[model samples]
Target chain A: MRMLRLLTVIMLLFSVAPTITAQETITVDFYFPTATATITNPEAGESIEAVFNRYAAAFEAANPGVQINVVYTGSYTDTRNTIQTEIAGGGAGPDVAVMLTTDLFSFIEEGTILPVQDFIDTMPDGEAYVADFFPAFLLNSLDEEGVIWSIPYQRSTPVLYYNVEQFAEAGFDAPPRNRQELAEMAQALTLPDGQRWGVWLPTEGFPIWLFSAFVIADGQHFVEESPSEVYFNTPQTREALDYIISLSRDYGVMPGGTLSWGDGPSIFTSGKASMLFHTTGSLTRILNEAPFEVGVAFLPSGTAGEDGTGYGAPTGGGNLYLFANSTPEEQAAAWAWIQFLSSPEIQSDWGAATGYVAARRSAWELDPLASLVARRPQYAVARDQLAFAQKEFSAYRTIDIQGIINSTLSGIISGATTDIEGALTTAQAQIDSLLAEYR
Target chain B: MRHHNALGSRVADAVTTLLSLLWLSPLIFAILLSFRPPNEPITNGNIFFGSTITLDNYRAAWSVAPWLTHYLNSIIFVVGVLIVQLVTVTMAGYAFARMRFRGRDTLLLIILLQLMIPSGVLIVQNFATIRTLNLFDTHIALMLPYWGSAFGLLLMRQTFREIPFELEEAARIDGASLWQVLRHVYIPLSIPAYTAFALVSISSHWNEFLWPFIVTRSESVRPLTVGLSKLVATTDVGALYNQLMAGTLLVIAPLVILFMFFQRRFIESFARSGLK
Candidate 1:
């Protein structure tokens, strides 16, 4: 009787399956996370969703039987978590998603993300198009064996933002070129009255600006050749950390938590901070809202004790990926959408509108916005800084590294660990333990 | 002697008003912040009593997404869950309250055990279950697990117990069947308990984030809290504070209004349950 019932079920599915496939339209859900802070700008304005919808509509017009539905996933982190849940559950996840590059390496390891090399291989101009992305961006998107898993959607490098008015008051004609001068200028501009602090840096989602500077300063490798080891407690690491710690204790230039969220970017906008180290992506937001004349410059060189050369901050942003769970037709439809968005014309427009750097070098030459930035000397600073762009080696458990750094840094700031050497040593011990687990 | 009584009454009135203000401060702050633009500098004195009221924030919040769709989805989700719960819990409560069967005690113990397990622990498994049923991205998926509440069952079972057995006997004697006895007598007598559970269920599911976030991927099925949180998390604060505040106020107002209207009944139900 059980066998008979099973035979009947199989027969029922066989009959019904063709009818389901005969449906005209294939619907793909695209989950988008809105910014955590409520954007006052209407969706009709400069938000990514507005641009996404325009592309979605255009894609639908070009492709028959393809309907793209966009849903708001809350915050960037929440979107990642939400999609992970869906994928883990073996349910319908987003066909394509915008995810932080910092997270890609780990996600791919867990078999959640589809490697894009196969998808790109089938396209006519896929190789050329893939090559258009900045070389530095490959770090986050590629595996140890160099399999491309995702395409760069948005990218940002940290730059120094200073108040022009404040700089003039401090008798500085231009932004400081190196770390020592930058610190001295901060001390010069800082007032005893609770009016302002000299410098601030956000410790939020992408604290890689500080981390990259530290790594580069210490001449430490972010990840070993095999992508297995992270050197967090090298001599350069200690020296770089000691300097940042001094900004608060020794220089008296930083008022804690003002420049940061949980120690990130709140200080600068509040007018309590004169200079902020933050992403170029934030430039648009600052321009839209800052009351003061903002000046942009490359991050100051971390004085290498002997060479006096400073390292560049790490690049941060999301990459677009096609999920493996999607149907072949749906995957093709998603590929078309991604290609349209990544086109030189579209990328340039997006880069101009939003503060994201253009992923394709070709877009920079052809984009009107790029030309506009070229005319402005300050924006040119970012273009020049791109030469030294670094991407975090999120391969060795990025979140764990951050946790160790945050706890150690928190202890240093709170004066709980008065000795930076001891605190950093403890942190390195923890990081080594984590690295050992991965081994 | 009468003067002393009057002074005590004044003190009581003063404390009540102060407490009320304290409870309402968050609402007041949200309203105040909603008027400021994102990234606009807000010094201590510029806000609070001195600032001009504005509607730009509300306009921004409305335009950010299809918030109206979110509201509709939330209503559908909350109502669907509550209605299903009303049936499932009432039936289960009736069973456990009146009916006697073999291993009944063991069965009740198993149901009670579910209450101790944290909801977070079940999320990944529950999501998998929903996927197996092919209910992902639908309102039905969001409502499925909530159809029966273990706590609601216990509360309703107790509520049914307090009613006289004579009522059930009278209905049965009048030629009413067991189903009719349950539907007509036990259900009506247990309205307060059901009302309590309804409030708890609706408010909790209304404010819930992860489950709906995980299950529903389309705006057509998204609840308001998720929509509101998405907007809250991404925007620049200085530029959009006022607008975010307005959006927040609109998102939370319905629940606040519902609470205001049902406060007395809610408290009384809880009080009764507490006694049990």
Candidate 2:
């Protein structure tokens, strides 16, 4: 499966290893998740891996003596754990890798990744490159010290997806704008006798990000932006969880069970639910499979009587990171590769290939993206939602902290527990201990 | 046989058939689901059989991942791990079963202790060890941790012990060397145990995902289970049940085919292994 890549690596090591002149062959390993195992499953053309390979070749050819090994590490967490394990073992991982932006603090604590600010300070025109991306997309990348730790890559957000035909049948011309209307509309849409429900909030899959949308809608950051603290026991978190649980318990709008994350979109597309909340990453799946018209909207806002801006989503997905352990030349090469990958041209291509939102502001101006948005329009919803997006919920011990909150939310929403405040308190306790060292 | 006994035997056979079908239902269901067209959402009814059946999902699954590469990697990993384990376990089992040595019982106790310690519990240390050895991103990394298998050693020891002492004695008296006696006598007679161990080792390594996933940085070294995982990564297409099932069926196809071809031998080996 990796014979081609391995040969390239070997030839690259040979080509660069012995070079003795001013061209000090910078060998950089760029780790990112591949959408397919297609080095084995090589498709016809323009697959995500193909695009990256093309970029790697272009970068290598464009910069003589700089070789890029584009390694397809399995997933975001897989890459993070791989790097962390290596770091813990007194070794360096990939020169550059795609780290989950939510894992910014964990990576910072490990002291394994060089802040992008370091790269920017040394690289030419790096300021403009940093500024080119949508500011909302950079919110998670920036730390309290204002060091940019990462660059957005394949970012996404959750959105409200509804069956437009069902909406029309229910006499609604537009999607719900706030929590109250959503409840009322969901009640009207649900027909248990007809074997259909109103709405379903997937209990398990990326529940932390999904809950972030809820907490944001209620007008509170789920955790402090400094990544030093959490606000899980606040009114916002409780109100959000209660509202989620109430849909099943109080309003009877959604079913009371942990609807598997994998089944969420299919449940909607199958006409089992009129509306579902999920990542905009799923836009293609919904559009292709829906038997009827579908509409995409920002997740409805909370009933906080806000100025039409209470709704927000967590900016989700991986970020490009430079490993701290790489040599100056390799780091410089990594920075160059990052710049090439993050350019508006590639970002737009990436967004189109995968349903991730284009991370750069300028990407929307590109032709196919512009035309695609004009036609499908739903493709634009995740981008539009970015305006209201907060940096995704992040803290020290990011995964475990979120796991605590997700289990609490899932438990309450699924009727496994009635104590929202108590669950939040337990989660808060566990996280507090986990982050105590940082504090 | 008496009528009652015959009737009871027939009834037991029916029950066993029903249980086997129940056990096999998940595999059957996955295969059936793989035949579904992508447009069709999986439902309770679709589990029986879909209204619209197509091999489109299989084509899509095959085109999306390199199952052949995964198949090759899996074979390499399984065979590599097993070959190493066989040599190590056989020698260790011979020493424990026949030769007298100090701390033998204590050593056996320690080996058995590993059987109690879940492989997952050692993942962090093993990962650290792998990284330290600079074996990350290689198939050897996947094999290193399992090379000294405690269960295999124990299974071999039990099998060697079960071989009549008179056989080893006969070989030794015939002027066979220690290695020769063990090889000619113990190894030859432990066919069923060897088969059982081979079966267990192959399937276990074939199905292993987590450790291999953690170790492998690229597709060349990753096996079918890891490749199948990419199918479910379903970043956007959510579950894509048809495609997922298709990929899963393809991953286990080699094993299933092996089982089908070697069903009698497999059952016979296990039955004769004295496993109980």
Candidate 3:
């Protein structure tokens, strides 16, 4: 009699709950870059994966029979490698993946990723969702054909990080506002005894990243915004490279070794260096880790942008792409997952939790970020710098061309080779050949 | 003279200990740094400061990815590959040592030549082959290339050759079959060689990141190395030194623990199975 009662209850539950048949279950493989495994907040190290899980749970509860698998594939580069390998190996990999915005053209060339519009155009709120992204972010997400290929996820720009105590001792009330001021200030703060160095820009980081900012501040773009023409051999570029080499070469302010982009923030916090020119993505990390008060300012402009808003720092970070190989059901599920992640509420918390600037303007008006800005204005600087922010080197083969330019710069700075013009000339020739087919 | 000799021996021990510590410094730093807090200054070159320590990094690292699945997958992957390797290597080694065969010397030369060929040189071909076999994302794909290890073949062949033929002859006279002779005589005495080979196989597979990363796309097949990297390695954000080290420590902890418990067998196996 007890067994009969249990069987009757089970039947009723199945009838009411809507039985999920195997084929009807939509499984979305969501692959994204791993930035903060834990919490991203400057004050509280929040578990980003936990937030993703919560978002996944909410989406699951609202829409029955759909499962979201949030797989944190290594770095942005790793995400690209995984996607390419799967597609080339003839396997349908993650339904959705995130990679650097500069990877758009490269993916387009591969012909593996679906345009975000493919799914967005089918949604009721598609138009508004498309319009909601900040124009600055939209600049990189859209291709030359005006078809949007990706959605801006975690975007950022480089800024100057300075030590307040070191500045006071150097007798400067304000951080340097231009290249000339930077050289003077760096000279004042420099101590040759190895305990503290003046100013250091990591030559060992990503190719064509921070140095591109200097090119923009000098009123020049490294590659044409559309990435068509070669500009490495120009006098303008040579000037920018000379100013960089002069710091260690003629000025004696920076250290003489190959410094890595990753080592910048750590070196600063350890009081090994006084100033660091690094990404605003590191703001939260520096705030949380540094024992001293940290001050941040716009990167000093070159002579061209005397007003300091000259074609500003280049933006660099991860953007979302829809995999083309997924089923219609999987794609639909992936579209829903993208919407949930890109929603204002979720993006707002994302900005506050992680140091990344929210991709949409509306997210800035939302609660925690709005309050975060009010309480700590330092958090808002990266977003404010967006007015001047330009897209990084996005070309047919972005990393390759940038690598050539980077290795050239590295040679000049490290004193391994002295002829900057000779190096740039060789790089210019390589760029011309690399871009010939693209043109 | 007695006092001087005692001092000389003490000096020699101290010198040897210092050299060992020097060789082990990077490992030591990784272990110690795992305990340090994120807020502590690690690059200031004072890694030994014990002002504050926390298990928060471990907690944070654990929550990032599915570590439980990774642990299970890694154990199954290494052990499965090792077991298959033992059987194949032992049998092949026996064939080379005792059995007469055609073109045996030429075949041995061809197999030994594989030792000079780096695994990286064949990645593209291996990947293509894996796809053709329809085993692209499976753990079996990861184990396929490594199943017939050239180094293992060489090691076992050398070990088998050192064993006396009298034992096998004695067993055969008792009317035992060839299989029975191997089971009773060769297998029992070659424990150290097998143990030594097993250690090498386990550690190599455990730490291998690149191939597993290429083959496995989902969490179901990911090993601890890939999982830990996904947890801590971010492009935009710099690594959380403590958390990264903690995750690394967690990934390496099992191997370290195993080595500690089986220190004697591990050392003896390698010493007795010294390179031919």
Candidate 4:
């Protein structure tokens, strides 16, 4: 009796399997980082997974015979690691994944990603679609040959956050516009005996990020279109490094040694630091947590340009990339899913819900975000700063190169290495050797 | 001599207390931070008592992930791994300790060599094997690679060697079967070693992140560490330390409580087994 029952079940499975394959739905395994895990919409009170599920449901509803499996890969680093491991193991990874913008070169070098340009070329409004993105946000998405590899999604830039009441108390009606004024303002706002520092420009962890702002403001960028080159030992970068060290050692506005990136916002909110150089993604959190009024402004310029705008910031965020290990139909569905997520309306909603700057220009013209920005103008500062934003330092061996730069900067700033020029020169030499293969 | 010994003991007590406090500081900080008001910064008035304590962080952290499902998955994962590890290590240990076979020492040497390689380096190969086995995104995949622990096998083999051969001989003389003699004699004598290995295996697998995160996709299969990871935002976003600490506490609460309950027994087992 048991044998007969098992035989019937096996026969049933054999009959159903063929039909299931005949009408198989195209399933796109969408792996995304939990970048927005902490972001919650106050009005809707929806959790992060809920928001993701809603989007997936909407996309699937619009396109029949297609399914989206949303996998919450931990962080940007974890998502990239998972994908790399899967691809190296000869398994089909996620059909689509959101990874750090700086991962473009490595992914391309590994040949694991499908260039989204291939899909964009087939679109009727492809040119306009590509043009709609902020150029700063797209800076890291393109390869050296000018082929697009990814689409910008959650993006951000560092901005100057000041204590409004402290500025008023110091008799400053406006935020600093130049480096000199910034130094003076920070000094005035600072209290004696370490009660409060003038500013908390964090130089720990990835110090090169905020340091890039200073280098760019001084009329140079550390990296260019070439993935194998970096200008780490340039006069501009040295001056920037010197200026950052002087902020603590000479000007006595910031604490000596390396300040932690994780502690900046809390220090600012608690009035232990008067001004903070932090990502705009923390704007909402700061605005809510701060007891005093908060003010946002462009990072003060080191060298004023002809347009009276020398402000520069490095864009930092993740981008959507289509993986290569998928069927053509699945790839098409994944591309459509990407398009839906990056569409103007979705971007606007996403920007408003989280504090991330919307990558698309038209997203700011839409509802929730437009209204929110109108009420609180601080949201627009990062977007406006994009006009001077540069690509984040990325290269073929980005992680190893970043380690060299970060450790060099940390060593100099922390007073462990006083010879900035010599250290940077050595770093440049080391980076050259590392990137020689790519060249 | 008595006075001198008393002074020496007192000094040792002081040192031990200091060392224990050093170890406990992070947990202490986490406890304080988890109870802190959500918006209150640690740099306020006092680091410890900066603001009025509240349950808000716990409330918020609890809602971020499905803790119940994660708890179930974690329990299933650790228990499942421990069970399989116990059976395999016991059988393999007996074979190496007592059973005579061709090239036994060579095979034992090969198994012991795995202890030198870090598990992280084997992720690619293990993941491929799991994929081939069609166990991706399942709890079994999360537990499979860990089932044959080289450290446990070696420890068990050494432990079985330490047991008196007279005990097994007595059991065999009483007409006990091979399985009965091994089970009632060798197993009973090596309880301390088994307990130590069980604790080591359970805690390590409980806290594992990268392997489980790579293998499982759904919440139904992912462990508590993956759930805890959801509370961490990318570098672009600021850290929410209060809620993060709260989420961490929620994830590790079970293991911490279990250890507290079995604290005495754990120490005794480790002491007897000469394992730490």
Q: Which numbered prediction scores highest in TM-score against the true structure?
A: 4
Error of 1 at B219 (Å): 1.0
Best by lDDT: 4
Strongest candidate by DockQ: 4
- Where does model 4 exceed 4 Å of error? A1-14, A17-22
DockQ of each: 0.43, 0.48, 0.46, 0.62
Better of 2 and 4 by lDDT: 4
Q: List model 3 lDDT by residue over B1-276, tens digit each.
A: 999999999999999999999988978887777777766646445768347777877876787668899999899889889989988998998888888989998999999999999886676677778988999779898888888988888888888889999889989999999889879988888999999888889999999887888787777988898878865575565657777777888898899899999989989998899933
Off by over 4 Å in 1: A1-31, A34-46, A63-71, A118-131, A204-209, A257-259, A262-267, A305-311, A327-333, A371-380, B1-18, B41-51, B170-176, B179-185, B235-241
Candidate 1 CAPRI classification by DockQ: acceptable
Query: How does residue A296 of candidate 1 score in lDDT?
Result: 89
The sequence of per-residue lDDT tens digits that candidate 2 reaches over residues B5-39 is 99999999999999999999898878888887666
Better of 1 and 3 by DockQ: 3
Cα lDDT tens digits for candidate 4, B68-141: 99999999999999999999999998889989999999999999899999999999999999999999999999
Instruction: lDDT for model 2, please.
Output: 0.81
TM-score each candidate. Answer: 0.88, 0.92, 0.90, 0.96
* Predicted complex 3: CAPRI docking category: acceptable
Estimate the lDDT of model 4.
0.88
